[model samples]
Target: MGCCSDFLQRAKPYVAMISLQFGYAGMNIISKVSLNHGMSHYVLVVYRHAFATLSIAPFALYFERNVWPRITFSIFVQIFVLGLLGPVIDQNFYYAGLKFTSPTFSCAMSNILPAMTFVMAVICRMEKVDLKKIRCQAKVVGTLVTVAGAMLMTLYKGPIMEMVWTKHVQPHRSSVPETTDSSDKDWLKGSIFLVIATLAWAALFVLQAVTLKQYSAQLSLTTLICFMGTLQAIAVTLVMEHKPSVWKIGWDMNLLAAAYAGIVTSSIAYYVQGLVMQSRGPVFASAFSPLMMIIVAIMDSFILAEKIYLGGVLGAVLIVVGLYSVLWGKYKENKDIKESKVMALPLAITCSEGNGHNMDLENEDRRERKPMA
Candidate 1:
């Protein structure tokens, strides 16, 4: 009974992880489609958080009805940091990067989050280091390899001949034009921005992990953070779009995209991720993002009619390989820890018995050697 209960508990997080991946995958496609339809990244972010704030409010109110703690200065500070790191800096940089780069590139860059999170966690002393252990070594090496893969994906276009061959066979090639000088420059700029976005995202992960330690209610904390983020995003948007004409909201695909991002991606996806984090921990929960990248790439090709170049495919493969390496290393490390514990239990029991036998022998010897009093 206990084993079955434990199995179920473990399985819950895996399910939540899958749900978060699906939500993010859908978010990528929807955001790209919305952007193509002329949604300014700023306005989209504002609406995304606004809707997320609204969606989470009812749940927060109900779930946290009677016993909600009064907001303390520390809690306020934590929420402020969450607003700054995640919703503000992270999302702003992400959308800016997306504007300059392809969704595929952005997705590929996201694979670096785990490594960045690991590094930041180590720096913050949240994670222990054991360089002698294969698990730690693998994690360190795998993270570096993943970063290398992201760099390769961003910087190297490979030979034009390979791109030409792949494009000739791919169905979406008909829609996409051969690279032009202007577009190439745009792509380069976008790639660089995406890398920056990835780094910012990594920072957000570290902040979130730390914040979670303080705020026990993920739902309420997320809701409050999103509310604060929405306000910050709106303020930024208003300043950036000083002209009233630019602030006009239209009921089109862009609006739909914003709604999707807010309701589905931000609110639902974040909620699911938080649930998963509770069970799986940050490392396992994050390992699923690369899978979302693959899903997004395929959906983008079919739905958004985007071209898949050979370079993109190679980059995707490298990212996956690197991500798996890190995950596998972590898994092996966990297994070793469990095995060590199991082995130590018997040794501990044997030592206890040996001590008991020694005490018994000493008592017998003392009794036998007693004076005839």
Candidate 2:
């Protein structure tokens, strides 16, 4: 019983993160279906955030009401930008890209998010680099490889690798004359849009990190951000979508898309991922994103009868490899930083103990260093 309990404890984060990815993958596929059904992405964004706000607001009000951070102008400004970057720009462009491209392709393209975040962090002076360091070199190379894979996927479609299932399904698909030539152009356009969306997402992460320093109430902050995003999305949707028909819903896929994305991806995901990250760290939580892409690919092929291209497969492989390399580098860098802090702790304590204990401290330091060496 003890052994089983220990194993379950160790496996908790793995289970949570994998489950989170599946939730994300489902959102991608469902959102794709809704988009194909002619649902406006703008209105979808508005409704999604509205539902997210409704779901999260109760928790924030109940659990965090007493401890909520005092909202200052700086914090409000940060939250405003967070809403714009995430709900307004990132989500709008992502849905637009999904409309123009296959769910599998969009998911694959989104795998570059970590690499984009790294670049943005460096540019924003949040991350440091030393070319001489192997870990730093790995991060740089990984970013380049991820970019190259993205470019390859964008520029080269190659031939579709026929699947056993898609064989019968392709013939059943509409024989109506479809503009294949325009699809290539749209694919390129969608790739650009997805890239922009990913960049905005990365920027949101960077800014969120900065905002968290001032606002420490996680649930309340999330609720406020979602509330702000809902308002922003409403304004944007009003400007972009004039037809009231776009917002109408009658228990359809669009409603599912909005509800599932808002509750599952927005609210539940944040809560679950926070729990996992608390136990295992953010890197562990992030490492499972590639699983979402893989799950989306399989689901797309099976459900949507989407064609899997050879170039896309190869590019996805490269991106996955690069993602691991970058993650490994980050892991090593963080480990070293922690070890350095641990090493410095003894010296800090020793100095604070005054000169009388200096000799004893030196002896204890030698003892600690022996095992470390």
Give lDDT tens digits, candidate 2, residues 1-373: 9999988976777688779889999999889889888899999898898898899889888988889888999999999998899888999999998888877678778877766677667887877889999988887887778766765665587998998988888532521124688877887788889989988877776777667668877788788878899999999888888898888987989999999999988777766765654444443455466667777766777876767778878877877777677767877887798899999999988877777588788989898889643
Q: Which pairs clash inside model 1?
A: 100-190
- The superposed Cα distance between candidate 2 and the true structure at residue 244, in angstroms, equals 2.1
Candidate 2 worst ten-residue window by lDDT: 170-179
How much lDDT does each candidate structure score? 0.73, 0.79
Q: Work out the TM-score per prediction.
A: 0.81, 0.83
- Clash counts per candidate, in order, are 1, 0
List candidate 2 segments past 4 Å from native. 1-18, 158-185, 270-290, 358-373
Deviating ranges (above 4 Å) for candidate 1? 1-5, 156-182, 333-373
Name the lDDT value of residue 151 in candidate 2.
57
lDDT of 2 at 189: 84
Cand. 2 TM to true fold: 0.83
